[model samples]
Target: MDTTVAADHAKLAEELPLDQIDVSDPALYQQDVWRPYFRRLRRDAPVHYCAESPVGPFWSITKHKDIVDVEVNHRVFSSSSTLGGIVLRDRPADLELPMFIAMDPPKHEAQRKVVQPIVSPENLDNLKDLIRGRIRTTLDSLPIGETFDWVDRVSIELTAQMLATLFDFPFEDRRKLSFWSDASTALPYAGTIVESEEQREEIFRECLGYFMTLWNERVNAEPRPDLISMLAHGEATRTMSPREFLGNILLLIVGGNDTTRNSMSGGVLFLSQNPEEFAKLRARPELVDSMVPEIIRYQTPIAYMRRTALEDAEIGGKTIRKSEKVAMWYISGNRDEDAIEEPDRFLIDRPRPRQHLSFGFGIHRCVGKHLAEMQLKLLWEDILRRGWTIEVLGEPKRVFSSFIHGFTEMRVRISEPR
Candidate 1:
């Protein structure tokens, strides 16, 4: 362990609420319990190390500028297939999928291009009506003055339906797709359910089987404008082998599922917590455009992403050696006071809110960012127009994973539309 990491850890143990700092527990992430500790880290040790983990010791890169530098310079800090995927912790071989998000340049660029057109701004605009309809239907389904799990009814449903439309999959079974995606991504944190390699392989095989069925059906059917068909019949350079295709499917499922779902739940929670901001949106719904980025900044659905140092590099005045894992704490960076004024307050009209690190930075920045924003904006618009006061009925439950930070269950009551 680096001397800095040792010293920082010792300080953290003494000054911080070390016992409550369990990154694996979703509840901790939801209540924003890590904020104070991260604030301490930012002030004390910007580039620190965690000398222990399920995946062994790793460095925690918690500053805004430092994370941007690592994200932009992909050559120095690679998201390669060999050095384990973007998550700080490594998974068992059987559960690993060769997704582009986990790949470095050339290959990552090639694979990314396959689905890039589908998520482009123009394509997203084209889907606006379809998206609005989905949101309206979802909001309508919630009976007036009823309490329900917001995570299940709103967040999961909206994203799943949008994903179903995007992939040209059967909308009726879209929830199953969300389930598989969650299971796949959460396998690393699954204690008894996915106890061993065999269990993990079984779950993945089941997911792959369903995807294979969809792939074969789409490959034979008439080409539609959906992502699957686009990849099926797009330019030669965009074509992918079955393995790569499966990898991309898994990537889409995981990427599309958690981030937006968490953001939806987080957005609602943020509004409920910050009633003033909610009232601001209620007044000027047009701010939904700017509000989307602010919500992302406040929620920060994905807590951190990992990168392996390909060579010796200096970040934030700290030396990182070759092959060392550097965890970019997006949660911490988004709240860096130097980057945004009044970083702790949730301001809907925060100018240049997109500058936050929620969606990441540079080349590997989230490709589905536009789509995520679109969905969030549409959902908020629908909620506001319905004139429903969202009340938190119970404490939200978060997913037990360090990789994807999100809510698993959040109960809320909606008042009758005025």
Candidate 2:
């Protein structure tokens, strides 16, 4: 974003009537000027309502405490796909699919349990060396003193590799995992992967067809630890419908890809912007323990998770009626002053760094969070060991979406290994 545009957004956020201020505009996130708008909402109306947006009318839960209240009270606030699913925009009936994340209690728990073993402590311990080896290879292959996109070269590559391993996906076709993941969440915007909803569905059909082939093979064979096999063999997921199968596949792909990939890219950008923190990390490498969660908090990979009100509920002294949509702005909540100290600054060694809502809370909390953290810890540890100095070459080109708060490109150059 340029100086003029940023100034204009700041001005609009400050002077616009409270009801007219719509933080749902994708432009605010694309230009990386969302802080002012969210700051205004958090300060004045933590449970603010927008009567209009490109999507539709919805209530914004901006504060830390308020967002948690909504997340925990799942009975009142439903994540059911039949009630428009977990994103602010309602998908067309044909587009809607019954993923576990978008389901309510008993069903959600049963389906979620099917894949829980993939990230179990023993499994992660088994996968550690493989993750570290991949990270080392990726870092070692970067061109010294030459500018490159860290998002593609490092972040996407590493996460795609890991996602492939988790699914036991064909090693040669790993990039397809990322392409499908991007297509799954992509909206019809300029520079977006899919041109229209029809096109997006076309891509999903291809994904479903490919995965169904794998599912057939896995289902017929003896059980194994891969996600597809686990789903095929597990009692809860074995009887899933085709659409439900596709939905769960997309859910796992997006959950695995977006959270870790975006945060990896964001960490590089954050450290570049905060050189003093980078110096702190270099001087005391042990700070990586604290720095990992701090990165997730500061980056806030997925911006918000939407839930439909199952019944009238009071939050922040306001009544939200049944069927009204509410956006739990994790991005805003992570920076709430009442929750986090010096919310704007990127602190590498902050105490209680994991208090933020990046991985969410309550029963719907991220299942793969420990795996994500381990990947980050291993990657940063390898960088420190390599003694490589990474220099940011330009401002990151952010994803043009309100939902997925992420980067598309981040140019950087690595110094010669010390």
Candidate 3:
């Protein structure tokens, strides 16, 4: 081997421990133990490889610039159906349901256009009042001076309702949709994977079966405002088979549900830790608009997204071979020294908050980005306006998955209504 190849092997050996980096613990996720490791990778091995069980080894892309390059140049580094899924590890055959998030362009663009308008700014503007009302009702229902699970009460409730409204699904069963989405993204150590997978398929069938019934009823019916109605009646740019429709619906639910849930939980945690910042927002509620993005930056709910190389390519002076998997650590990228000033600290009024990659970058970026922001802003505004005091009663529990980093349980005490 050449001298350069020897050095690359040495570097890879040194960074082999990244394969053991477990994100299942809340403390590890909160304190961010991976930041230092990512910083080293960004400095020495921007395109380092690691070997692991189940799925073997894959390259780790830590630098913000490199991540953007791979994300933007989807032609070379594609999200195709044949190259496995978009996740770091290969999913079980039973649970392998492909969505647009894992598809390359032409097809991806065709499917994306179907639901894009429903989540656009104009449509979101129409939803502001309804969202605000839901927020108000959620806060009002919280028991005063008693500890309760904030994750379930606040985050899940809000996002679940938003999703239910988006799909025109029965409001009462919205939580079931959230449950299935959460299960579909289970991590290696999240022991509930097997059970969750079984349950997910059942829930999906139930939900999709109902939607199909609705589709039949609405096939010849007038165009309704909900996403399902639009998708059912829209031009057939890409035909959505029953399986594909269920997969995409499940994708939207998981995408819209978990990230926003984590952001809401993270927002409350930030407020509890930074009382001064909370007070600043309470004093001037208009700041909630900008504060939403700051919370996303600070918490980075969706920690990382994995992509596979379709062909051999060079990034940040390193060559990635074809069929190699690459994990984009968004949590570390958001706090990249080159990306933002005082990246560690939570600053509500930070200028250029949208610069954060929390919603990701390029064509594969989140379609519900605007909707998530509106929900966060409205929730914060509602909490402040209602004169609520959110006290952290205990330590927050983190999810076991690296893909969707969020709270499983957050005990909190809400003060009485003033």
Query: Every model's Cα RMSD, please?
Result: 4.8, 1.0, 6.1
Q: Across residues 307-365, which tens digit of lDDT does each residue of candidate 3 receive?
A: 88878999877788888887787887887888788887888988888888888899999
- If both were scored by TM-score, which would come out higher, candidate 1 or candidate 3? 1
Q: Candidates ranked by lDDT, best first? A: 2, 1, 3
lDDT of candidate 2 over 333-383, digit per residue (tens) = 999999999999999999899999988888899989999999999999999
Could you tell me the TM-score of candidate 3? 0.89
Misplaced by over 4 Å in model 3 are: 1-33, 92-95, 188-200, 416-418
TM-score of each: 0.90, 0.98, 0.89
Instruction: List the candidates ranked by TM-score, beginning with the highest.
Output: 2, 1, 3
Worst 10 residues of 1 by lDDT: 18-27
